[model samples]
Target: MRIVFIPVASPLHDEKAVQELIHQYKESVKDVDSFTHLITSEEDVQSVNIRQDDVALIGVLTGGTEHLILAIAMRVRATALLPHPTQNSLPASIEAQSRLSLSGYPSVIIKEWPPEASIRSYVKSWKVVRSLKNYVFGLLGQPSPWLVYSSGHDIEKELEERLGISFKFISLDEVYHEYGLIMDDEARELAVQITSRAVDVEVPMNEVIKSVKLYLAIRKILEREGIKAFTIRCFDIIKSLDTTACLPLALLNSEGFVAGCEGDVPALLSMVILKELTGKPGFMGNIAWVENNRFLLAHCTVPLDLPTKYKLRTHFESGRGVGISGIVEERTKVTLFRVDPLTQSMRVVKGKVISGFPQSNQHCRTQLWIESSDSIKLVTEPIGNHYVLVYGDYYEELKWVAEAMDLYLL
Candidate 1:
């Protein structure tokens, strides 16, 4: 994984404590060469010529400490990791350094973080995995909206410096203009077929041709550079095409291409992770959820090659946080939970199970009365909070799908 090591350090008093943090990450990631290091510093970083063939990535640590400046100058690169709010928990000097570095880039501000230390660690690890996947990439079609920024150079620089992946830039015009010159006859035929479908759908035949050409261009570039995996910005290009073109595009997604709609970082990340885990082409989608006092999230995993069937059932509910639920169309699974009526104590009566998928219209109801002698304590547990009864198994699959898309887990 291409991890970025940014050690939070103090700007004043010339402290070396921050450097220790960097070493800690380095120690944890034994294969340090597979990572990009950014040292936070106040001064201008020094100069060190680094070849793409030698290092997997180049990142300048920018936030606190002089060490970061030296490191940044040596590597001479800028990336998203340089702008995080790591200094929030640090001492005043380090915090001030971080504030200065993030002055202009408000979007870089940290809005969300894990509540638990363990969760934070996992999330960070996931980020590294995401970065590694995006490093080596290709452009299949037109420029994605996310790439439309101040300059094309900025995107190229980000690809080169952060991921160490060189881009084979091709404009929509060139792809439409000289597609016939493409060397691979077989690939060209496929491209032509895709282009023909694109035209039938009113997708600006020229732009479709351009996208096909771009894909061809990227294949050649990746082979020459010995790079594997890539993200193509297909949103803008696709919008130009009519709705009918969606089918072929969707089919391409199934063929192991790391594609994205708008240049969504999380989508790209999820696609890469899913490919690694399932060895299949992945597309970003949301989990189906049923609202309740507590929300439950869930999703279903179906093998592409097989015909499968399953069921779902909900046995109980929890009173503390929002209860969530999920279900899949073809598989059978059930999730159950319960809350003590008097104390509102919650428990997971059941988790994941496979049987026959639960019927969507079935309603589950349990009567409770605090005044009753036997069930008084149980009935009163949830008395203070508003009560909402939801009976369904669709929430689990939806919740999992939401998480896969990096949706907020509340």
Candidate 2:
């Protein structure tokens, strides 16, 4: 991503002062492709060609930043203000943004870094925005009846139109048909690979093989349709096919494809971004309970690689299909986030894994007790019932992404 440093300098300021300010700005933004100046009333704003998808860094050297900000925003849709070089720099930036807003021009503001140094966050976020062009997502079957926070067609279409990610619908019947048509040997091979890691297999051999069949079928569809990420109506699969998709979803995710449960579009979309940032898929789970700084997260299945412990089990409610009982390491860093379909907003928080829940039949089999730095938002401002949890601290990347997409981060 190239950056054009638009230094708003007035003739009243000494030329030496403006040069020193530009020097500091260049040192801070040391890695970008290019830096050009648009000195106030001296350089022709109309003559500058602001390229598409570029971020303009407002170098607040002197007064009269509005004209420069407006000129940059006119051609480049996104603009930013880097960390201030001096105390007065920030106020100048804010004043410039205010005037731009008054004139109906918008600029993204990055105030403080979580420890900054990762200036690449803005570049990475812009890359995600450009990379999503023509990206396809598969939504297999309808959302579960319990997913009250899920969206309908209008919201789905709106997301597709606004986010540039195409969503395609696939039916359960088609998946079932493919499951029945897979070669017997392929299912057996997948079953062997899956059962090799289990501490104890509670599922019957036949059902285990069927889960493998579903896995192969889903993979076939994803490869054929060019679907980068997918979510399924797992409950419907359990009811109609007499087998749960837990194992297959886990395998798909571990293989680098984003697989979400309950046909949750937002959860799957969050997973897509996580995969892009972390190079790994995330876990989607219900917020079972909350207490002070700690909250409980549990799910029937997760990507096989995430857990330090794994055991096969029956689906929590039906007790007739495959599920996973897995454990995450205590004190492991994690970030949980969810996209609210209605508002197109994302709620994100960083935390550490505190402990594992006691083995029980009541909740989904896999459980994690997470302790957040600030739990007030978890209690007071939940975006939805479920959120995607992935290992590592991606707070800056998420923040930059939210900025680039114009998504509200609550």
Q: Which predicted model would earn the best lDDT?
A: 2
- Clashes (N, CA, C under 3 Å) per candidate: 56, 0
- The superposed Cα distance between candidate 2 and the true structure at residue 178, in angstroms, equals 1.2
| Per-model TM against the reference | 0.32, 0.87
| C-alpha lDDT of all candidate models, in order | 0.33, 0.77
- Over 4 Å off in model 1, which ranges? 1-134, 139-168, 177-227, 233-252, 286-329, 332-410
Query: Ten-residue segment with the worst summed lDDT in candidate 2?
Result: 110-119
User: lDDT at 286 for candidate 1?
Assistant: 21
The TM-score of candidate 2 is: 0.87
* Tens-place lDDT digits, model 2, residues 1-410: 35555666665676887787678666766446567754676366656545865677666676545566666677776677654545365666777677766776547656653214645677667667666665787889988888776757776786778777888899999999998898767788768767887878888777788888899999999999998788899988887889999989988898988899898888887888877866877998988888888888889988999888788888888887789888777889999988775786888889999886435679999989889866667668766677899998888789878877788988
Residue 101 C-alpha lDDT in model 2: 68
